[model samples]
Structure formats: structure tokens, C-alpha cells
Target: MNNLDKVKKIVIEKPLKLDCGKTISNFPLAYETYGKLNEKKDNAILAFHALTGDQFVTGINPITNKNGWWSYLVGPDKPVDTNKFFVICANVIGGCIGSYGPNTIDPITKKKLATNFPVITINDMVNAQINLIDFFKIDKLFSVMGGSMGGMQVLQFVANFPNRTKTAIPIACTASHSAQNIALNELGRQAIMADVNWNKGDYLNSECSPDKGLSVARMAAHITYLSKKGLQEKFGRKLQERDDLKFSFDADFQIESYLRHQGSVFVDRFDANSYLYITRAMDYFDLVKQYNGNLSNAFKESKAKFFIISFTSDWLYPTSENKEIVIALNAAGANVGFIEINSDKGHDSFLLDVPEFLKSIKNFLDANYKIL
Candidate 1:
């Protein structure tokens, strides 16, 4: 078996008290690693995944039979360069993929937690990751990197554990979700719960698992991931399958067909309850609140070098949001660098094959990180 095939499964028992006042025991964190940790354990890099992403970072996901989510940016010679740095990617605490999620069987009830799974926040996810790092005996991380919700975790990590990281990179993310963004997430949740099969999020044993509702939720959110120009260019008035519009309920526009496919495929690989939990966690995130309402105070004691990147077209969390983070870091006297990649791909550009994005990362790591 290759290295990816030798993947190990680890489950960290949750502590009695979580940051959110929840008692979660037997918390499982599913993760995978590429390359090897050096003797000093100084070469470790923690790669945080976005809202819908799982532990599969640079290899194929055996569960879904699909390529890893961020494979474009993480291989042997890619920007992350697994050949040198030991990369660790884990599904967040409320995630479904092998992690203890709403879908996991609760030892007490002998059934999946489903809707009973305690509410989790972004801080809870980062705290779980900190536990994993502690288990690995990695006292400090060489770098912590991510985008979107992943980027939120990156910032949370630095704020919560300033001494544990050497470098921090949060891409295309905001310190807190805007009211409009929160409203969008709420609508998605409402769509899922609106399905009669939802049964208050306890639909694991139902005949059909709210697939339609989840599909609609995914479709709605996926629209936010792309730039308006990208959507227009990729599929505007173009008809789907047929040259002429049916003008009925059938999908006529190519975008509708594309979104339908996205929704259908997403349902197959993701759990609706997990989606609800993760999105709620993201919506509850506000890093500045823990810092006396001063965003800069969040990084007052940080020693990590910071790299914040944003895309011009990502209105979901535009460049201005990134600048706010950069400004705070600067006010705190933290060493920081900011870059805005000019792209029409919107928030998803970082995950796609963007040469300049990769180059920026490569150059940053080469110049600052020591290779041992």
C-alpha cells in the first residue's frame, strides 16, 4: 500500500468540559498526514479544511471515491509541498467523515446523535484540533493555513493559542460572518428542516434522507461560492441537454442543471445534520468577542508571522474583510503580509488551479520557514 493507503484512524476522547459548556466524551477526530514529522517535530503544518471539506487534503478520499478537496495546492511539488513539510488535515469536530458527528453512533443511546448532537462552535473545532496536535506531541506548528471557514479556524487558533504557531495564513475569510451571510446560512438550514422527512434533524432511518431539501440547500450556498461573472461565463442563458427551453419545471438553463448536479452529488457524500451543525458553528463564530471587542486584541500576544490573502471578486468575504484582519494584526505589532489575488473565480479561486496563488505560498514558505 502507498502512504495514503496506510492512513491511520485516531479518535481523541473529549474532555469533560468544552469551551461551549458542553460535555462531549469519546470525541473522534478523523485525520490524515502526508510526509513525515522530523525529529524536532518542527516541520509540522496544520491544514484546516473549509466548511464542506473533510480530512482528505492531498490524496483520494476512499469514502467518496473522489480526489481530495485541496489536491491542487498540496502535493509533493505543490505550494504546500508535502515532500518537505509534514501536513495534517482533519475533518472538523462537527464533520461527518469518520469524525464523531451527528451521524456517529452515540454509545449512550446506541444510535446516531442526529439532532441531539450538542451545538458546536468554531472555537470548539479549533480546540479539538489542538487536542490532536497535543496527542501528536507537537508543541508548536510551523504553520496553520486555510480559507473560508478554514480561515476562520486559522485566526481562532492564533488568537487562542498564540505560542503554538509560528505562521498563520487565513485566505478569503472574515473575522465574523456578515448579517447577510448569516441570513444565507439560515435559509439553507430552513430549507433542510422544511422537508417533512427532516423530523427535527433525526432522519437517519427515514426512507429518503431529505435529499431534496439538502440538495436545495447546497445549490443555494454553491451560488455564493462563484463570482457572478464566472456563472455568467460558464453558463448563462445556455439550455441544458436541449437547445430550446422547456419553460416548465424541468431544468432549462445550464446553471440549473449544474446546481442540480452539485446538490445531488453533495447529498451522496455529506450528511444533512452535519451540514446544519457546521454551518451553525460558522455562524456563531466571532473571534473579536473574546478579545474585549477589539479585533487587534485578539492577536495582542501572538508571535506568529501572518499572511492574509483575499480575492477581489469574493464578495462572500471580500478583500476588505481581509484588510480588516491585516489592520488588526498590524496594530498589535504582529508581523504580517497581505495579498489580494485578482480573479473572477470568487471565494473558490484558492481551491482551484491558480498558479499565482500557489506561487505566493511557495515563495512565502521558502523565504521564512527553515528546512531541516
Candidate 2:
């Protein structure tokens, strides 16, 4: 974050009225790009990142010093094949990294926005990124793709700007946040607020953070990203570097240790307030409601090709939910494809090295790119 200025970004001089009834201008949308935009600029792909993801989609993230969140799928000769197409990814508004959010100091106030930042929605996030397209002077994008929260943006993008992209891939996402998911997100938000150090989202003013609460929230959310079967096979009742269980409350099971590690690392790179805000945005997402309860109507005007994908083990956003999108697209008479990949990796399957899933994406993009 100290080197945020090094990241690529564009300051939108045009005013963007957020769904929360607030207007903002001269805001930054931090982004990163890979490969080259061809002469026609038709080979560019706009990739949206999920919750906790940043502009780094592939290669080593300069901030985290780790591989990009979608490294497996976006590098040269990989599924997204950056070698053949230019890829652009941005840190969404209401996100912590470089983008305008709770951690960003308000230029006028000279203080962190914290809880004062306007509550943003998925629609607002997509609209902010549209500035990037205009900045690049791109007439249209070759493709738009993402998974989980990112996938949600993909659907919202195509629906909002039907003619802006040639193809759209929304993997392991839903048109509306299910009650169950909303509850899970609430649990995470509550965990953050419960921390005494949170101090009503003013922790930064006191030179402290709700790291403990944020860690617990991450641990809980990480479980939903993995399948039950995957957990059993990978961790199960295996002890963590011991022959017998500790008699105390310390992590005894390997699964417990894994989750704890996940939580700990997450708190280091992510902001608690950003987590709260983004989850709220996800819960408020209801494309169906926006279209008057007719999910098909959301895409009725979109001519972009859509490919919906789901994982066999993803109970978070199950095949059934994904099928709903496909069904809506079909009812709208849109050109769309659907695939329920066989994987034990749950909702995180799209981020992992699932050969079948990777192959499908490669084939879809390659075939479609040839058409262009």
C-alpha cells in the first residue's frame, strides 16, 4: 500500500453518482494490464476481481509478493492466454488496495473515510470501471470474465452495457445473493464489529486494527470457498504436527490450523472495513429485483455471448443457481452456454488448476477470438 503510486490507475474527472445517492469525481481506479492491445483494440479483455482481489491478476503481485489471484488462468499461454489478448483488471471502488475506499484518505478531510465512505453496490462498482474502457479509448472489449464476486460483475456488466463486450463469462455466481449466503456474510460482518479494537470503524485513528475479528471472519468465509469433501480429504482429523490432540483450545486439527493461517494472512493484506462494505454490496446485489423480478429482463437487451459455469461441489453458488442465469438467458433468447464442471474444489474451482475448467475457458476464448 505504501507503493500505491507505482500501480497503474486513472483518475476519473467525470462525476459518478453512486447507488447510495452520493456523487464522486476525481477518484482513482487502480488497475494493471498484461500483454498488448492490438491495433484494432478488439483483443482486450476486462477481468473483474472478486472480494479481496486486486488489480494483480497474474504474475507476482508487487504488493503481496505472491502470485496474482488468478495467476493460474491469466498468464501467457494459459487459459486466458494473455499472450494473445490484452487483459485489464482493476481494484473495485469500496476495495482496500489503491482504489478509493475506507482506507483511502479523503482529499478534503485529510482523514481516512472509514465508515463515512458511501455504501456502494455491484452496479456502482461496474459503472466505475467503465471509465477505464473510455480511458483506453476502446470501442469494445473482446471478452469479460470472472468468478465469484468477479463473476457477479461480469453479469452486471453485460446487462448494463449490452454492446460493450463480445463475450461474457460468469463462473460460479448467482443473479441474487441467496438468504443463506447473506447470513454467512452477516456472520463475518458481525465478527468484525464484535472486536473491541474495531472502535466503531475508527480503529485507524487509534493506531490499531481489528485484526483478530478480521482473521476469524476470513477463516469462516474461507470454509465456504472449499468443499466439505475437499476439506476432509486434505485436512480431515489429521493433527497439526503432533501425534495427539492438545488438551487446550489451541488448534489441534490440521483443518483448524489451515483456517487460522488463512485468517492471519488475510488480515495482513485486507482491510476490515473494506470487507464489511464489499460483503454488504454483495448482499444488496439483486439483478433480478432490478429487472422487476424477471431475471431474463436483465439480459433481454444484451447481445453479448454468455458462458455460465458451475462446479459440482460449489454449494456456495451451486450449479442450480448458475443454471438460473442460463435459464434466464435462454428465456431472453440470448446466445449462452452452460457447463457444470466436475470438481471437488467447491466455489474456488475457478481459481484453481482444474484442467477441465481451464480447458473449457481456453477453448471458448480461443474459438471466439478466432471469430473476431
Candidate 3:
């Protein structure tokens, strides 16, 4: 393959420290890049993926045959404009795609780690990202952006490597995982564990996949991504096909059918154990609590210009939480711009085609991230 068409992969063969007191070796990360790095190598943008997201950010997903998740905003002439900036996105650690995760082979046992893989925290994922950045010989990122769990990673990156990023955009996220967030994740985990097919996370050797369990988990979590208003507008007591109820145990309403479809399709491209590990990593994320419960102290050293967005209808990561981060940044004396986007798209507004959100992102990048 030509240099421009290269598929990027990085291997950390040496032991790396983790916040959980465990050291990992031979950690592999699969990433994708768009545009090109210039002579100065300072035009790179690092994008972090959400819980179930992989490395494909702006290309056709080989397995799903669908456009990249954020293709609307990351391509040439788009909001961030890949034609102007070199964009890099890696599948986070504890993810199933081409990256190190619970389903991968363990060098020591010569078998898939399955349930044996050591638990990882969000900080550990950022540490792995640092290695990938170092391998590419990039000293500073032009910008870093993401939403939901992706947003959490962006916050951690700016906090940990303050001066390394010129700008930070974290949408629909908080500086730390709220107690309600942990509860929601726990609900999904329970649904997975309750499925008999899970077989205690050892389904790999048994040659039996936990499709039902994983599907149920995805179904439960998908509901949290939308707002009550959005849900009502989309499928409020609407019947599936016929006007009358089936009077059976099958999907009776439109909402039920949608959730089932989401669950089934998710299991096709995602692993059950990987979901467990990733959600666990998110649940353990609490930046302020980690720094003695002081929000100001958490972002005191951040030098990146901040632009935070939140949806008015997003109950998962409400507008209030987004402003809390901005308030702390203000106290820390960080350059910041924030707006509460008026949208009914809920926490998934950042992923949807919201004109206001797009305009705001484009204007922010144009102002803060200058491409020369």
C-alpha cells in the first residue's frame, strides 16, 4: 500500500502503568487517519470514540457497510473539515474492534482473555492514547473532540496533558460520571449477567456467544441516549404494524420494535465482554473525585481553549452539567466558550444533523484552530 493508504496500527510491547495498579504489555491499538500531516506536523486532530464506537470515523465501516458514525461533521468541507486538518481516531482500549480488549488473546495464557482481562479505568485508555500519539511523532494536537464517553476522554486529555492540545470540544458530557450515570451502566451490566448464555463471560471457549445477553444490554442503554420528548415525538404509544394490539408477547409498540432491532444489530459487531469492560471503565471515571473532589483543581493546569456544547433536552448529560465544567474552567482562568444548544435530539444531538450544533462547531474551529 502507498503511504497515504496505510492502515495504522500501534503496538506497545513494553509494560505500561495503569491507575488500577496493573501493568499491561503488547497492547495493540487500531486507528484510522484522514487528510495529511503537513511539514510542521502540527495540524493533527485527535478524536476519541464513545462506548461502542470503533476507529472508523469518516469512512465506510467494513463490517457494517454504513457511513462512518460522525461522517456528517468530520469530512472535507464539513464542520471540522478533514481537508484542512489531519484527523486521527483510535479504538479505545477495552474495545472490541482491532484493539486490545477482553476478547483478544492473552500472550501469557495463549488464550483469549475473556473474563480474565484486567479491569481498566478511563485514565488507562488515555495513557494508551498517549503512546499512540508518541509513536506518530506528533508533539501537540490541533484539537480533540468527542461526545458522551468520548467527551469524558476529551476532558481527561485536556486535564492530563494541558498544553498538548490547542483546543478541546467535549459535547454532552461531564467532568466526572454522575451517580445516575453509574446506575444506568449498572442496569445494562445486570441485563447481560442475567442471560444464561453469558456463561460467566467464558462463552468464547464454549463456542457459544452471548447474543441475547448483549442485545438486552444494548437495548437498555439505547433508551438512555434519547430524551422523553424525543421518544414521545418519535414513537408515543404507536403500534408497530396493525392498529390493534397483537395481544401476544412479541413487540407490540414501535418503541419495543426499535429497541429489539438495536439490540440484535449491536451484537453483530460488538462483543459482550468488551461492553462490560468499557462500561466499567466509564463508571469508574470521576475526575474531580480523583483530585480530592475539587472541580477547579481538576482543570487548573489546562491550557487548551474550550468549547463545550449541551442539548437542552438531553437528560443523560444535562445542560447544567456542561456549564459546571465551564464554570470551573472560568475559575481556573482557561479560555472557554460554551452554549446550550436548543434541540430535542437528547444526548445524541452531537451525532445527529442539528444545524445549530454544526454551525457552532464550525465557527469555533474557524476561530480557535487556524489552519495554515
Candidate 4:
């Protein structure tokens, strides 16, 4: 079998019993692996993907026919250094890319889940990943690293299975979803559901899917992923492919064109209903709540060395939020390091080519872990 076929073959059906009290039987989780897990399984690194990301972490994506999202940091000689560590990136539950999600058929109903899918949470996603790890027979992960929504998963994993991780890194994430963040996600959901073409979440069987609404939602969320300064630097009143402005509703600025392209391309590979479920899951995430509303208590049992990173311009989950994580780790008496990198890339900085971030990660791993 080819690489894609191998990946497909590894999918585990009925990964877990979701938090919603629903059993997702015969589910599939797509993942990609690099390097080999040593006999001791000490070289394994679990890399989680952010919202809109998939299992294609270090190599080209066969399905989308595009380059891997984080190839810059996870190559043969890069910071993740596939040559030394066994890296595994799995599509989170409620994800559309070969994973159980709203698009998955309900065996009992004999129909696609659509809007009938159970509401999932970050805890659910982390729990499913733990199952996968157990299936692989990995007693412990060398590290768990991620950014944004992925970072939230990292936090959830550490909180839920403190003994399973040797090191935990959560970059550009919050301990819980802020009210403002929840509002933003709710607005996006509203936009998608409001579209007449949505057909009350049954757009899959409709003549035309809710592309316009989904595109608008993507455009809005994409703005939060970028920094104001970055946007200004890249496209400050610049004309769109034309010297003269149309004065019409057409995309007049370069930023508008860029956002349009992002939205259009996103809808082609993503399911609108899946987007709703996953974003809602993120909005409902609160790691502290599980520990009696005390963030520090959540980490009290964690023995992993923690590295919490934040970008200066990431307003979505500002430096303040990362500091909150640091404070909790400190209170828990966990070995922790915190860094706020100077960057104008917003929450997307962790995924982008940031030299300082890469350097810090490399140095931290080198000093602490035995990289084979």
C-alpha cells in the first residue's frame, strides 16, 4: 500500500465513548507518523493540530494536494526533527479529515450526523487521543506540543493524564474560553446557520451547500488569526489586482482578496456542520472547571516539564492568558518555563516560520530531553 493507504489502514473504529454520552462506533481517525518508535517508546512526540488543521503535520497532504501545514518545524533536520523523534499527528475527533465528525454516518439512524451529532469538548478529543496512544502501546509521550485549539488539547491532556506526558507545551492558548472568544465563535455559528442554504444544518443533502455563510465565518475567524500590524504591513489599503478601485462591493483591498482566497479554499475541504461542532467544542473548553474551578489544582498532579509560549500580538489568547498558565504551573510546583516572543503574527505565529520560537523550542528540548 501507498503512504495514504497505510495511513487509512491505521484508522481505529469506535475510538471512545464521548463526553456527550454518545458512543461513536466505527469511527475513523486519520494520522501520519514520522520516524520509528524505539523499543522503549521514549522518542515519541504527540503533536496536536489547531482549528482547521489535520493529520498532515510534516509531509504533503495527499487529500488536499497541498504542502503540510507545519512542515517548516517538523522535517528531517528541523526543530521537531523527524529524524530523531517519532512524531504522530492525528486528526482530532469532530474533525472532518478522515475522522469521526458531523459528516460521519450514524449507524443507528442510517444517516449522516449533520446537526444530530453530539456536542463534544476538548476533554473528549484528548480522551480519544489517549486511546490511540494506548492502541500504539506507548506508555508515555516524550512531549505534547500544540498551538491555539491544539494547545488547548495539550492542556487538557496534561490535566487529564498528568502521568502520560514527560513534557507539555501549550502555545497561544487559554486555560478556558473567555466570554469574548465564545461570543466570536457563536457569531460564526450563527452566520453559518442563518444562511438559507444551510437548510437547518442539513446542507449536505441540499442542492447548494452553505458556502457563502461558511466563507464569511472563515473570513471573520481568519482575521483573529492574524495580527493588526501584520495585516497593516501586508495589505494597508493596497489595491487588489487592479490599479483602480471599483468603488463597488468587489474586493478592493489586497487583504480582502487574501481573505477571500482563504475562505474559498477552506470550504472546499471542510464540512460546515463539522466546523460548527468543533468551534463550539473549543468555546466550551474550561480546563479549570474540571479541577473545582482552580487552574492550579488541575496541574497539581502533573509531573511534566511545562513550556508555555505566547506571542506579543496574539490578541485571541493574549500573553496574559499564557501567564495564567505559568502561574498555575508554578503553584503546582511543576518545572515550567515561560516565554513571550516578540512577534506581530498573532495566534498563527506558532504555526508560522518564527525563528525565535523555533530556537527556543530546540534549545528547550535539547537541554531537557535525550534526542536520539
Q: What are the Cα lDDT values of the candidates?
A: 0.87, 0.93, 0.86, 0.86
Better of 2 and 3 by TM-score: 2
List, in order, the clash count of every candidate structure. 0, 0, 0, 0
Q: Which residue pairs collide in model 2, if any?
A: none
Q: What local lDDT score does residue 71 receive in model 1, on the 0 to 100 scale?
A: 90
TM-score of each: 0.96, 0.99, 0.96, 0.95
Tens-digit per-residue lDDT, 83-149, candidate 2: 8999999999999888888988977888899999999999999999999998999989999999999
- Higher-ranked by lDDT: 2 or 3: 2
Best by lDDT: 2
Candidate 2: which stretches are off by over 4 Å? none
Model 1: residues >4 Å from true position, as ranges? 1-7, 14-16
True-structure Cα RMSD, model 4: 2.3
**What tens digits encode model 1's per-residue C-alpha lDDT throughout 18-67?**
56687776667888888889998988999999989988887778877778
Alpha carbon deviation, residue 10, candidate 3 (Å): 0.6
